[model samples]
Target: MTDSGPVLPWLVIRQDDNGNRYRVGRYATKDEAQKIADSLDDRGHKQLYWVERIGTPAL
Candidate 1:
């Protein structure tokens, strides 16, 4: 089926010092990720990680 809905971008980022290389969560967009990062920073959640674009998975 063809979809006419507005597309939403997504990305994944790994948390720093989490001990799990694959510990990551999906974000609606990079902006969303940045917002989360800011919150984490405010909470003193010091960490480092990466972010990359991901395609919507087919169901």
Candidate 2:
């Protein structure tokens, strides 16, 4: 789904090796968030990155 609109609703999340997760940033689309995540992952750090949509219910 295309999420480019008035506001940024995508979130970039990062989790380190210890399993601590935090917010990295927000973007207008999933692609933007993924791009940042990819770049960060490529840095060779022992961390994991992923993107999530705002308002998504936590499970």
Predicted candidate 2 versus true structure: per-residue lDDT over 8-44, tens digit per residue? 7899899988889899999988998999999999999
TM-score, predicted candidate 1 vs. hidden true structure = 0.43
The C-alpha TM-scores of every prediction are 0.43, 0.80
Error of 1 at 7 (Å): 6.0
Q: Candidate 2 at residue 26, lDDT?
A: 91
Q: What is candidate 1's lDDT per residue for 1-59, written digit by digit as tens?
A: 12865444554454568555453566657887677656655666656555556654522
The C-alpha lDDT values of all candidates are 0.57, 0.88
Which segments of candidate 2 are over 4 A away from where they belong?
1-6
Q: Which stretches of candidate 1 lie over 4 Å from their true place?
A: 1-9, 22-24, 55-59
